[model samples]
Target chain A: METQIDKLEQNKKSKEKKTQPEKEELKGTFAAVLIVGGIILVGWLGVFGLFLERA
Target chain B: MHLHRYEKIWLMLGAGGLALFIVLLCVNAFAMGMAPPSNMEMIDPEKVMETPPFDKPGLKQVGDKEYDAYMTAFAFGFSPTKMEVPAGSTINFHVTSPDVVHGFQIPETNINFMVLPGHISSATHTFDKPGEYLILCNEYCGAGHQVMATTIIVK
Candidate 1:
């Protein structure tokens, strides 16, 4: 009976594990990408603004 | 592939940004007519001086406040030697090169174009402020390229 109880507990833990993703360390990747993209967008907009002002 | 959630967001953002740039460029270039200076009129390089319009390299009033300035860019100098415009006058500059390539640029204005041997390049600018504006050759044509400049007196 104890063995059966332990098997049921193990089954429950495994089901919880199935719902979670494996740990992948992406340290500062998202922030770095956003900063770079922001820089490019800002620079492009600045140049476009200058063109419009001059044109 | 199992992409991370933030990765997917940034990827979509990047694609959207690129698409935005292309759309803006197309709209400004086609719809708004803000394309670069391009005068498609071609002439015989050998007969640039003999050309009817270019032969008379000077300013001619087109509208009440607009002038069509036909000018030639030669080996080391520009024809007509001098020009003067009234304040708030808009000058449409049609420039051509007889010898080699040269740059026609007016400082503090949006009139900058290349004068090619067989082609005419044109740009327009309004002289709103009364001052002496310098039109200089920005290309390295020869030893006298630095001296290839003229003044447009705006009164």
Candidate 2:
């Protein structure tokens, strides 16, 4: 019985390990998206401001 | 080709970004009437000095609040170096280079273009604010390229 329980726990741990890297990758991608979006937004605002100031 | 789900998502996002950029550019060009310089008119570079408009390079009042500014770009200077126009006046600039390629740019406005020999570049801008706008040549012409500048005084 003890050996069976250990085997089941090991299987669960392995499954979790397989998904951990994917979760980290998704987080990194989300961060990259947010950073890019922020930069674009700032650039657009700066251009619009310049146009209004000069034009 | 087999693509991972993340890769497919990234591909779609990149395509969408490109499409958005192109659409915005088109709208700004067509709908907003913001376009780059075009060489619709042509002229003889040698005879540019004798051309009707180029022959008279100065500000001429055309209408109630409209003016036609005929300008010539040379080796290291521009004709009609100093000009004064009324505020809230629409000025049409017809520029040409008589010697070599040059640049025509008016700081603090959307008036920037290249002056190519044998080709005429035109742009229109209204001076709504009363200020001094400096015109500078961005292209390298010769030794005196640094001094190739003029000013437009809006009163």
Per-residue lDDT tens digits of candidate 2, residues B38-125?
A: 6589999999999898998999999988999999999889999899988899999999998999999998887889999999999998
In candidate 1, list every pair of residues with a backbone clash: none
Among all candidates shown, the one with the greatest DockQ? 1
lDDT of 1 by residue, B1-155 (tens): 67878878988998898898799789988998775666678999899888889988999999998999999988788888999889999998888988999999887777788889998887888788899988899999998998999889999
In candidate 1, position B64 carries an lDDT of: 92
Worst 10 residues of 2 chain B by lDDT: B1-10
Candidate DockQ values, in order, are 0.25, 0.17
TM-score of 1: 0.82
TM-score of chain B, per candidate? Answer: 0.92, 0.91
Q: Please give fnat for model 1.
A: 0.37
For candidate 1, give the lDDT of residue B35.
52
